[model samples]
Target: MEAKENTTPTPTTTTTNQPELFTASDVARFCQVDLKTIHNWADKGEIRHFRTPGRHLRFRRLDVLDFLRKYGYPIPEVLRLGKPKVVAVDDDPVVLASLRKALSKRFELTTFQDPFDALVAVGSIQPDAMIFDVRMPGLDGVKCLERLRSIDTTSHIRCIVYSDAEEMKKNATEAGAYDFIKKGEAAELRDSLERLMGLERE
Candidate 1:
């Protein structure tokens, strides 16, 4: 009897073989950095990416948008809206989502999880200000502030870090935080936000 022939055909990826939204070369060009720089950013947790089961790195287009919006890095000699961008970085997804939903109408708020990655976005987005949580996974609020000031791109971006701990607030402010808010009351937050945006404070 003849051996049964194998009938199952292996599946092939047809839809643009690239599962990644961007490659190192692509990121180098977009962020105006070298491929090595992109790699470095990845290593430092400056950029958020996902690892495939095959060990390939995949970047999110949303993350890229947030990055560009962070540095106020304008589109080169292209269509520009000239509106300001704002970034909110936190470890808690719930808080991040809530902030985005609440402030999406008024400000161009981009939310992120990792503080270091948020700084990377700040370089690209050039947002007018930033709101970050004191406690995060990678970089803490104070460290994030130091890094922001160190970078020319985000040197002027307003840094705001809030915490329930008064000690954290004091430490954050001393570390060059623009404003600190307690975890509760949204009233103070609203007022501070309005003033920062040059809106009439209520």
Candidate 2:
């Protein structure tokens, strides 16, 4: 009998490639500005940028596009869709889902069910604003807000705290929360967020 060869299928993996990143020179050229100006924008957080492990600045293509839109610069055809970034943290799946449904249209929304992950993101992404749940498993919202305010990099971010417990509102406000929304008040929260971001709800 001939020896049979064993044939096994190997699993194939896929990777989601990130969008092309824009260097400072690329951004300066696209914005019709000097390279020094691009550096200044990144330094002051006027534009979003990522720091490489080697400490070099890298700009996101979409973020640069958004900056152009905000400054009335003509957006390129590939970069026309620009919206403000907002970070929302909640332990409840329903609340997160509601937030996505409500705010995704007007803003580039990032949601985190884990408060710890949200805290880390705030420091790195430096979102325009944040919405947090007052009660969560670890690092409750009030404490989280306080920590953020204490950090110079994240201190200026507007923070809103929401909870089912009415008494926590005072705690949230004192902790540097920009506004407090009672839990389950999705419409009110949406309106408040719009007002905070200077966006008119449609």
- TM-score of each model, in listed order: 0.55, 0.59
lDDT tens digits, residue span 27-111, model 1: 6777788888878888887776666679766665435445555666543321122223567777777666666555655555666
Off by over 4 Å in 2: 1-82
* Worst window of 10 by summed lDDT in candidate 1: 1-10
CA lDDT, every model vs. true structure:
0.60, 0.70
| C-alpha lDDT (0 to 100) for residue 183 of candidate 1 | 60
CA RMSD, predictions in order: 15.7, 11.0
lDDT of 2 by residue, 1-202 (tens): 1111112211112121323466888788778999899999999989988877897778765466568868978655443334556778777877788877877776667777777766765666556678877888866667777888887677667788877877888888999998888877878887886666545458
Top candidate by lDDT = 2
